[model samples]
Target chain A: MPTIIEKIFQMHTEDKVEAGNTIWLNIDLRTARDFAGAKVVKNLLKHYSSEYIEDATKTFFTFDCNAPANTIEYANNQQICREFARKNGIKVYDVGRGIGSHVVIEEGLAYPGITAVGTDSHFNILGSVGAFGQGMGDIDIAFVFKTGKTWFEVPETVKVNFIGTPSAPWSAKDLALLCVKELRRKVLGRAIEFYGEIVDELSLAGRITLASMVTEMGGIIGFIPPNREVINFYSKRSGKEIKPVYADDATYEKEIDIDVSNLEPLIALPPSPSNVKRVRDVHDIKVDSVFIGSCTNGRVEDMQAVAKILKGKKIAENITLKVVPATREVWREMMNGEIMKELFNAGAIISHSACAGCASGQIGMTGEGEVQVSTSNRNFKGKQGAGDTYLASPETAAASALTGYITGVDEI
Target chain B: MKVKGRVWKIEKDGKLMDDIDTDMIYHNKYLHITEQEEMAKYAFSNLEGWQDFPEKARKGDIIFAGENFGCGSSRQHAVDCFIALGINAIVAKSFGAIYKRNAINSGLAVLECNALDMAEVETGDEIEIDFETGEIKKNGICILKAKPMNKIQYAIYLAGNLFRYAEGI
Candidate 1:
């Protein structure tokens, strides 16, 4: 019996997909964003021509990163992408279209049992939908474009069982942080198959958030095996019947169990996502800005969570609160509902749904010596301009916005 | 493939740098810059004590790093920036998965060596590496032997890159 990943690979490769065996499989989907897709498209057209593109429709391009073109060079790069997409008939998501990863799922490009590759490392987010999302280099992506297939070294699979459900204020982000801490920064190049009650109970947004952070753990994929919840979720959106895959009882190489019953809201301190700490212990740390968006937590559920905390109340006067929805779909949903109104009325600067101001500071930059609590995946030094960033869930980020400090939702 | 060069030990405030993510090598602020040749100018621009690296680094120089080097972001520029700097190879205790893959695919030599004793080798120490056999010599002394790349990786490296390697296939 093989793990879910192995099983998927076997089906794609039509051979026994053993760990460390390199085999090529036809790619179901190829994704790229403006940040890296510019180079990928250039390389593809320059070295390999239209003939190299196996199927233009299978290739999806997006201009989410650095959207709105912060610089002239980026604008030029976006033009290059547009020209390439036009020539190849590839689907291109322009500025404010939303993140490529989210769009892939929303458009039903990714679904259960499919193998997809992307230029961004966080493509693993698609794994939450039971698709095999692997991040490949630009050359690899170009090759995949040129030839509708790519090779892979079957990775060892690790079983990650989330034993219990998370209570309020403790969303999937907190649960992911806990798993990251417990994994001890040694999960590099492994497929972490998340299962058990906690994963099955998490919403699609929560599952996507959980899978997005697997990059921080150095894992190739954070797979939540398909259950009825995710199957129905994808089927409802894609309007296609789907079959989910699960691992056998003894398929995984190693097992790690996480009990979320007592898990509290957590935050990854600046410079590294693995530097996690309990939210209550870091109350002394004040924040100058609060960002409630990113590929990780910029979803409808995350927006709803933040709005629930900020509704009927204003944020702290000293700090700025910025909300960027992950996609236009998410943004429209929030706007059509009360989330957008609650956020804006509560003093939040709700920016357009783009990758604005998360790491590049295209929209919201932290001032010198300032601190921030963000829901973004990365908190590396100066990631969001020249400030110390603390990574938290949307709930914590909203609660912190209320007090202008790194406070938990319960504290508010 | 083999490389001979001087080791540029990246340190700041008297502590060896660890987990130097791709952002530190090349920031997203410069992601818009498409030309790889021009990227070397901003190499280590965000990293402390290394902003002036482009001016100091020489062709065929090796970067010595601690665990999880080149972590974060699947930016090819992170690997390409070093190539622009004419970095011969990178010897670290470990490397981020994406960086390692990009490095190999781009024909940039990267080897995992456990004997990255910062105390044993000072900054600017001359080192020699045999990538095929995973041998490392510091100041003409064989200090460590890293695990050699598997057959597929070696073939890819020898062919100068993945594209060239795939051409023959």
Candidate 2:
């Protein structure tokens, strides 16, 4: 018998025809962000006369630019989206202070065992919470815009069994980078099922950090089933009492495990998400900029870690350090606490919560000659604004900002 | 897994600030800058060995770039460039995820090698690739170290997509 992932593939491969087989798994949840809306709306306006979209109910929209009052258009565009959703009766959520799309959704939206489709490539970051979430193009999404149904070819499942407690500053991001390095780029878009005792120890935020980067490894998604940690997470934010979603016990194409207990803070050099080495390996490499934000590592927990490291210290004079929160809610929490002040006092510019410098959205660009070390998932050269980009965990990126060289926080 | 293919030529790591090369992968007479045949003949435009490349260059083409090999939109034209031109594979030091995914889904191979050299490869040298195994050997030299594919990626390659399942895993 094939594993659950194999079952998904068999079903999609057979065109959803085989008995007990389904070719495409139905998506339980769908999400879209502002970056994709302009294109999506234009395409719809061009393709259809009156503006009809499929599957609007199963989808949700959230705005991330409320806090900084970033752009006049930011608030205006969100109002338009909210109005459209309200008029169409599509579910829209903000929790007032909702921030990043992935963070807000996993905070309360995703149901276990559900397949999620999003317009952005990084939406699969929620798989760490045990959901099969992935990305699609806006045009295909237009169909989902019209029907709320997404097509899948059922991917083969690669089982990643993680064991051993991860070393300090060496959290899920380390393992994720390792996967990207060892697995090569071809394995992308494959289902990744993360298991092992260590998975249980990671906070829900940590899992999001790990799952967010699964796309770095060329896998379709990365998932660890919901446990008490997740339950605790949901218990706080939601009263709807959504249930846990788990994959069928049987059927996986292959299983791979990692013992992160001994892992160190790893970093990916410029031009490749997979070209990674321990912080020690690149200690001597000089740095020009350091960034600690984005859906992958911009959560409150990550910000606290940064604050802990930068509280009394200032970043290197030549290096520019910046931070952005995962969501406005996270930003609010940080502002209420000492971390926000500490970061600003230490000379770190606070970018708004709207994916600043993460995707193409906004903020940070490379000059004629510049190198930036960041905690974002992709390090493909010039990924940030322009210039060279080096991928690192939050701790490493923070430390590099302090010394203007890649190093661990302890060294700073 | 990583597969080594000679780069037909590099496209762009960062968006080319000055010049806009159109006949990159697809043949569009609509652009009217050059004939589709001429573009293919001189394709990859000013890209080293790009124009000289046949309709399909084989594996072992080294794609060296400053940064961001596959940046812009996800148009499978680059993948189609390899497929239609019969280029065997591509080995860039880095690649865009969308480009890498599209290449794999389409059976065109691309590998990431920060140190790979197109200068070392003789054009049309018999390149070896085992996509299932992730092995790349060019002219008797084993260059890349490939890892195993995950379940879904393997199935996509084997079944040739969810639409056609000629073989079972």
Q: Specify the highest-TM-score model's number.
A: 1
Q: DockQ for the candidate 1 complex?
A: 0.67
lDDT of 1 by residue, A127-182 (tens): 88888987777888888888878767788988887776656546889988888788
TM-score of chain B of 2: 0.56
Report RMSD for candidate 2.
8.9
Docking class of 2: incorrect
Instruction: List residue ranges in candidate 1 displaced over 4 A.
Output: A14-16, A49-52, A165-169, A359-362, B12-16, B139-141
Q: After aligning candidate 2 to the native by TM-score, how far in Å is the CA of A184 from where it should be? A: 2.3
- Judge candidate 2 at residue A92 and give its lDDT: 62
Q: Pick by DockQ: which candidate is best?
A: 1
- The 10 consecutive residues of candidate 2 chain A with the worst lDDT sum are A13-22
